[model samples]
Target: SKITDLEQREKAQYDEITSLKAQRDSMFLDNQASQEKDRDFLKQKISDLETRCKAAESEKSSLKFEIEKEKAKLNYERDHLESIKSEMQETINKLMKKNEQLIA
Candidate 1:
């Protein structure tokens, strides 16, 4: 009777150990799957951010080029106006000199 009791106890403990091992394996699998999902989500987020960054860079370059073109046009117009002003000043000097000669 003592031997039989010892064998029963041993069997019960073995069964409990097996059950605990199964539960541990199942939890491990669930954790692994959750980690995989998180990894996939992070990767997609990174890709989206990269695409947005490229588009922003392209827009910035285009805007810079347009600003440079506008600056060049303004400079050309300024130079042309300065030349016209100089010619007008010379013409006024000629008119005043002739008027002074007639008065003298």
Candidate 2:
């Protein structure tokens, strides 16, 4: 009778262990699912960052092109102003020469 009672206790302990193992497995599976979700979230964030970087690079290129065009326009204006100043100097010299001839 004692042997039967001991056997019954052992069977109960074994059933309890099995139940605990199942609970542990369930918790492990839940942790894996949460990790997968985090990984997917990180991947999406990385993709978004890459897209933003490309857009910024494109914008920088466009800004550089605009700056070059503005620089060219400024250079052209400076050259045009220099040419007009030279022509005015030549006209003043000619007028001075005429005045000197009249004085003589």
Give candidate 2 regions above 4 Å deviation.
none
lDDT by residue for model 2 (1-104), tens: 99999999999999999999999999999999999999999999999999999999999999999999999999999999999999999999999999999999
Cα shift from native, residue 91, model 1 (Å): 1.9
TM-score of each: 0.84, 0.89
Q: After TM-score superposition, what is the CA distance of residue 39 in candidate 1 from its true location, in Å?
A: 1.0
Tell me, what's the RMSD of every candidate? 1.7, 1.4
**lDDT by residue (tens digit), candidate 1, 4-55:** 9999999999999999999999999999999999999999999999999999
What is the model-wide C-alpha lDDT for candidate 2? 1.00
Q: The CA-based lDDT of model 1 is what?
A: 0.98
